[model samples]
Target: MILRVLLISLFLFFSLQSSAFSLEPVYSLQDCINIALKKNPEILASKATVNKSFFKIGEARSGYFPQIDLSLGYQRSYLENKIGEEYSKQYSAQMSLSQTLFDFGKTSKQVEIQQQFYKATEWQDRDTVLQTIYSVKESYYSMLKAKKQKETAQEVLKQAQRHLDLAKGFYEVGLKPKIEVTKAEVELSNAKLNLITAEKQLSQALLNLKVAMGAVDMPDFDIKDEDYAVRKLNENEAIQIAIERNPQLQAIKFNKQASISTKELVKKEYFPTFTGSASYGYLNEDFPLDKRWTVFFQMSLPLFSGWSTTYRLKQAESDIVYYSSKEDSLRQQITSQIKNLFVQLKEASQKIETLKIALKQAKENLDLAMGRYEVGIGSSIEVVDAIVLFEQTNTQYWQAIYDYNVTYAQIQKTVGWVE
Candidate 1:
């Protein structure tokens, strides 16, 4: 009795563990977006670029503080004369400090340029995030669509098999022709083929979703069946939100500001600069022998630099104009995108309604035909045709559903909001 009880306990333990491991992981839309944003390599690379730009801010600020340097040197010299020859060794250590007394706001302008550039980089990172989120949504919805298609195919196959069996029964009893059995068998074969194709497509879609989420090697998983509804939204309001919050537009604005600061920085190069320096030194024949200190002040003016500075200033000014034009172009593009997606969303919603009605009619037609055949008043071809019509309408309805959800996701991305 004890041995039997121990075996039972071990079996129960293993069964529980197996059930735990076999549980299907289901991800919602938000879950997929979050995973892509957190783990996608492209998104991470863009983040690294933003960090590198942030470091430039510190580099630009370094010019505002005093600069210091220390150096050590050893020198050996031999002198020969008519009377005698002598050899001497000298060792020197020196420390120097230099401070910018004034530069007409040159360093400040440089710092401002770096700050603006960093802001642009930050916005670029946000844009990358938005793009990744959109991609995840696209893949997620596609996987859902494929799964639905596969389910529909399986249902159609089962119905076709039943019809083939019925046709065989009728022919064997001398109530139907052999051609009816052949037709039903052909239909069943077609349905089976479609189901096989749908299964392959579903597997491919699952792989695509995993790739989009950067979980390429993850175990087989499923997505939650979410019924996405179309929400009423004012088109003008959406455009306004896009203008205000779109990261690509914001990045462009920052780039223009940085260009202006760069022009100022370049123009400042024409003005004179003043610097003050002090140095303390020790010089000895062998060890510590003598100590000395020196101080100096210097001023420099760029009388000419082969016209390079002037060209640089012109280039900076041109960049400011270029970025401004780019901002305008981007605004136009964004507005057009919002309008187009809004129209598509509306169309998809309408299509879904139309397809739903057609699907209802198709089902009714299939039922009527089946009932007529059971009562010996209808032909088998009519029933098969009705079945095909019903399947087509059903597939169309699901396609419309997937299209609406995809368009909604794009609209959200265009407006620069995804949570």
Candidate 2:
């Protein structure tokens, strides 16, 4: 009895532990968006890039400090003709430091380059955040749509079951034909099959949303939304906003400025550089940096290196031109995308309204056909036609909503608010 009690207690303990850390049965789409932004792999990757950029800035700043080096070595040498050996081994140590007193602004330009690179990485991180948020939103809405579809299918199954029972009652009383009973059975069977399909699809959509939230082993959670529909975009306003506020454009502009810095660095190479170097050494006879103290100062000049420096400067100028072209091309592309998004947004609004009206018409048609069939005045063909039309309208509305959502995501992506 004690062992049994212990086992039960252990099981309860583990169950409670599991429940505490496991995914909750409830989550709002907003919660999912927050979780994805914090944990998504793309955001992690961008964070790493930002760290890398930080190290690069450090590398550029390292030049600001004077370089210092130390050396220690031993050597032995003999003369061709010697009186008691011309050379002898000795201990040595030396230290030298270098400072860039002047380099025609090369150091400053390099620092600027790294700073721009850091900004670019920050923009990339923001882009990743936007992308993760939008992706989660899309998946969240998809799951909501699937859940509703399953609910609708279940309702249809219940309706078909009711109709089937009504048909059997009528047949027993000799009020309905045999064909009507068969038709009702067939419809109930189809409805059951549709419910099964919808349930499977809904289950998969839920899993996808969980994956987006970075909760692969999460428990099942239902999607709840009062309405899933596209909000119309202000066509011209959106275009203007995209033009001014897009991060991609800002990123490209920063890149162009970095290119200009590169050109300035290259132009600086034409001028002379001045650096201060100092070395201190301790040396012995025929040895390097040994016992006796020594000190030296150095100032070096780059007389010429063929035409390499000139060609390199030209290359830098060419790069500036190249990046300028890419910037303009990207600008044109973003503009076109903004315009296209506006057009699609407008089109989707009209389609949704029209589909809503069509759905109402289809429902009326089904009701009329059912009433006729009940009075022995309607054909099986009419009933089937009504069913088909209603389902078609049902599927059309979901598809339209899906298309609208996808297009809106594309618009956000163009604006660099979505990756």
Candidate 3:
């Protein structure tokens, strides 16, 4: 009975393990980007900032509404007078309302400033999203590249095994020497080593992809291979698009507008502000209290504050200058980045085309060398050299493809083209 129970338990465990392994999820490039957008910490933080800034607009607009407050108090006092020592208890309740009559657009300017800040945060959030998407794409492409390289390594190992078998057969049949068999063995061992390295690299790439997607407890997963088509882009057009659509540039523009509004608000601080307030209250030492009411209007004028207002105005003006210069700097920086990325993308595209031809030629060379060696017309050295060349060309071709895809992603990010 004990043996039977142990056997059944082992079988069930293996079955469940197999089922779990077979159910691992496969994510596509788009799926990875979606995951990153939803889970990336930077994106979440930026979105929160955007939400916080939106509430600030409402806070600033609150100045347009009346302010109301209520107060209740109880106090006991002792006094010494000519009659003797006396104690008194007092209770009071009061409600008051205050409203700003006018202030030369000070409140309005404050609202405008907050609105501009809200716009800036919105753009900043967009920028963060774009950056996150780019990171996901980069990591996804790197993982794909590693996967392809691993496949290539496996193919080379197969080729090496075939060569070794052929060399052994030739040696046994007296068509080749023992040295040929030894060389083939060495080549096979090298192929196995390369495959091991490729597998390690692939595992590292997967870890990097998981990090980019902000996945903490992700199960083993696979990514589907994708075909990317190349597109032609003009540098001038790309630069123009980046200048118009870049989130950072848009944010800076809004920030500068907010600074200008702040300067306008400060200028109005020098003018007088008119306000009105009314209070109704009851006060008495006994249960039955007397009622009192008062209403008043007041004006506040800034006479002098050690030239602080003047300094504030100057500071606001300086902020405007700083932002203007910053805007210009960003434009130039974006233009330069666009130009550089375009150049890199073009080069990578060209390399893909070139390496495609090279890979084909290498395959033909490897096949011919193998055939010649089998017929005893070619040397083992020739075949080994051909194999190495084929593997190198194949790896380079895939690397070029990876570079093209990554560069294209960067260009999309720089131009604010999200998909």
Candidate 4:
């Protein structure tokens, strides 16, 4: 009975685990950002690059530590002569240790260079995170826009169906022409086709959002829609923030510092390097031991290396200049981007206001047209024209809203706002 109970318990546990794995999770915008940060392959790779920089530091610091080596060997030799063959056997053990006494600060400068490189890598990782956040915001907003568009299309289809029904009823009563019914049917067919297209667009948007989230499969869930308000911002202040806080710029700054350190390290090559070494050896012939020890200090100076040292120093100096120029270029680019996005955001906000008023007028026109047609005072074409105008205005209004939201996201990205 106990064995049977154990088997049932195991089966139940496995069944629950499987169900959990198969369940789809609904995600908010923040949830998507967090998941991408945790699962995106590129983000993980950038993190690993940061880790590699740490190991490089350890490698650089190894120059300050002592190095030791040991060796053991046995040899046998036989010589043939007229009297007889004489045999000789030898055994040896050797050990050596070397340490850098000084190199005019060469080792220390190398360590400093590696430290700067690590800093640069850390900033690069932060930049990766910022980029991921931007991508998630874009895809999330796009999905929301697609959903709104689909809803608009469905409403238009319903309006078309109502028009069709009214025309058919009038024709049955001998109050409308056959051509009106045919036109209504044509409009209904067109509305249905548009709705189908809208649905396909929504599906594609959902797939894009899932890809941005780094999800293995698309989940079935509703996204929470929230109204976005236009916020006031200062362009000059935004540009200042980007220059001071942008991770890409900061990474380039670190790279420049590393290059400077490398240049200093190359200059040290002009001075002599001092290294101390010691060795101990023991040798035996026929089991008799002869022991020896030796110690020495060596200094090395580059008499000439085909001007390689000079060329290396020049290369490091060029790197410093290159990074400095890149920094200048990036700052200019940030300024231009902020200015451009600010204008677009403002224009979109104004457009939304105009579309709101237009939408109101279009709805009123549709209502008037429908009332006239119901009273047999207006033609079906008037009602149909009003609907087309209303649908167009409605789509334009939603599109303006989408444009505003996307422009705001671009501004946030330019200013290096991670959230």
Candidate 5:
């Protein structure tokens, strides 16, 4: 009975674990970002890289530890000569340790270099996370825009159908021209075309969102669209945050520091190298072997390597300087982008409000124009103008919302989150 219970428990455990891995995220933006942070291929690779660096650190430090050896041997000799036959068995054990006496601090410096590289790998992980957040937010906003556009297309189609009905009523009574009916038919056709286009765009956006979430199959999902206007930010504060928290600039700065440390390490090559070793083994002169223990210290001098060390040092130094310059340039570029986006965010906020008002007014005008055209009091031209204006306003509103969301995500990504 216990064995049966254990088997059932195991089966349940495996089933639950499988469900956990088969991600079907009907996720919010926050959930998508969190999943991406955990599952992004680049971030996972960076984690592995950091782990490898840790192992390398241990490998480097192991050089400062001791080593031991043991041996056992047996020999038998048989000769049909003047000499006789002999047999012997021997056993030996030894432990030998060597610490870094001095390699001009080479061992310590190597460890330091590895430590810096690991740190940079940590920074690389952060950079990758920031990129992932940006991507998910962009896709999320894009999906929202696509949804709004589809709604707009449906509204336009409804308006076109109403015009068609009015055109038919007037034509049957002999008050509307035949061409007006034809024009209404054409307008309805165009609305259908737009609806089809909007749906296609929405499908593509949904696929992109799912890809961003790193999900194989996701249920129907909706993005948060309410209250999507950009929030106000003081330019000075935004710039300060970006400068303080930007991962790209910080990562390159770490890389430059690591390169400098490596350059210093290379310069140490001019110093002598010292190592110690010991071993225990059996040595035999006759059929029987004798045990012996041995210990020794090794010292090496780097007189010259045809300028190889010099060239290596020079290359390291150059890389340090080059990366430092690149770091500076990258900071400037980010600062410029932050400034531009600050203005853009502010402008987009104002534009959203403006377009909100415009949409309302256009909707009212379209209603009034439709009423007049149905009674033959309004011209076809006015109805057409109203349709265009209404569509334009909706387009502007949705575009502003998309822009606001993307910029908000940008601001957050620029400012590192509190750990």
Candidate 6:
């Protein structure tokens, strides 16, 4: 008896814990975007790349600082001469410092190259962030649309059930035939099937939202309903904004600048590098040691390197042309994308307005049909048709809204809008 009671108590405790764990958290659209920015692997990787590029700039500037090195050695030798055999031991330590006095602005140009590359990486990071935000918004709206579709299915099912009950009552009173009952039953079955499909779609949409948030392991959650205001953009203005703010375009421009700087730095390879060096050394065979010091200046010129320097200069020049061409191509693509998205946004807006009106009319027609049937003036077919029409129009209206929101997100992404 005592063991039985203990087992029951433990089961109850675990049941309570399970219930608490099963509760889902609700998040707004902005909350999902924030989470994605913080946790998305793509965004994290892009940020890491930006940091690495920034460090490269410091690495390039290191060429301007003096380099110091230390060395130590121990030696023992045995020798035989015409008179006798002898052995000697030696210990030595040396420290050396070298500084580049001049490289014809080579170091400065390298630093400039690295700086440009860093700027390009920063813009790339921004582009990743914007893309992630757009993904989150698109998924969020899709999930909302699915949820509304499920609700619509449920409502349709209720109407089908009501019609089934009315058909049975009219038949009992000898006002309707048995076929009417069969028709209502068939409609109810279809409604059930539709509701099941809608539920599955909603589940899939939620999973998609989770992936977009970069939190696939996150617990089940709900999203708050959001309404978007209609917005229209001027084609010329949108194109200008995309040109000015698009991260890809900016990154390409910086890359071109970096290539130009690299070419200039490469040209300096034909010139001589001027450097100064100083060294101090100690040597001894016993406890006390003799000290020696030396200082000197040197110049090194690349007289010939199998034309490697010349080839490198050519490569740098080619990179400049390649990036310049790439920049032109990207600008054209951006302009075209902006134009297409603008047209989509307009079309979605119009559909939303038109579908909303259609949805209202559908609802009114359904009401009229149901009222006429209640007054014994309408047939079962009329009522079922009205319900079906209402459901289709309602679904279309929600779809249009979803399309509008997604198009708006695409436009923002194309324009490089960040928040």
**Residue pairs with backbone overlap in model 6:** none
Candidate 1 minimal-lDDT segment of 10 residues:
369-378
Candidate 1 vs candidate 5: the TM-score winner is: 1
**Model 4 Cα lDDT, one tens digit per residue, 214-294:** 775745655768587888889899989989878888899999999999999999999999999999999898566699899
Candidate 6, overall lDDT?
Answer: 0.92
Evaluate residue 125 in candidate 5 and report its C-alpha lDDT on the 0 to 100 scale: 74
Which window of 10 residues has the lowest lDDT sum in candidate 2? 287-296
Clashes by residue pair, model 5: none
Judge candidate 1 at residue 239 and give its lDDT: 98
Question: What TM-scores do the predictions have?
Answer: 0.92, 0.80, 0.92, 0.87, 0.84, 0.91
Best candidate (score: TM-score): 1
- Where does candidate 3 stray beyond 4 Å? 1-23, 80-84
Candidate lDDT values, in order: 0.90, 0.76, 0.92, 0.88, 0.80, 0.92
RMSD of each: 2.8, 5.8, 4.4, 6.8, 8.9, 5.3
Off by over 4 Å in 1: 1-20, 77-86, 371-376
Candidate 5 residues 1-419, lDDT tens each? 99999999999999999998785445577877787777767678877887998888898787667654444545455556458665544444444555666788777878887777777777777777777778888998898889899999999999999998999889999999999999999999999999999999998998897787776375756565646644666777867776777777776776888788888988888878887877766666554556677778889888869999989888998989898899889778877887888777887888888998999999999999999998789988899889979988998899998888788778777765422
Total colliding residue pairs, candidate 6: 0
**Model 4 residue pairs with clashes:** none
> Model 1 over residues 221-250: C-alpha lDDT tens digits?
889998767698999999999998899999
lDDT of 6 by residue, 51-103 (tens): 99999989999999999999999999999999899999999999999999999
Model 2 per-residue lDDT tens digits across residues 1-419? 99999999999999999988785466787778777877777788889999999899889988889999999867776675645546556677788887888777788889999999788778767777776777787787788778767776775676567567767877899887898789989998999999999989888898888777777776677655736466656766766776666767667777778878887887777777777777787877553333444344554556788988788878777777877887788778888887887787777777878988998998898788877766757666677677768777877777667667767877876676543
Between prediction 3 and prediction 6, the one with superior TM-score is 3
Candidate 3 colliding pairs: none
By TM-score, how accurate is candidate 2? 0.80
Q: What CA RMSD would candidate 5 show?
A: 8.9
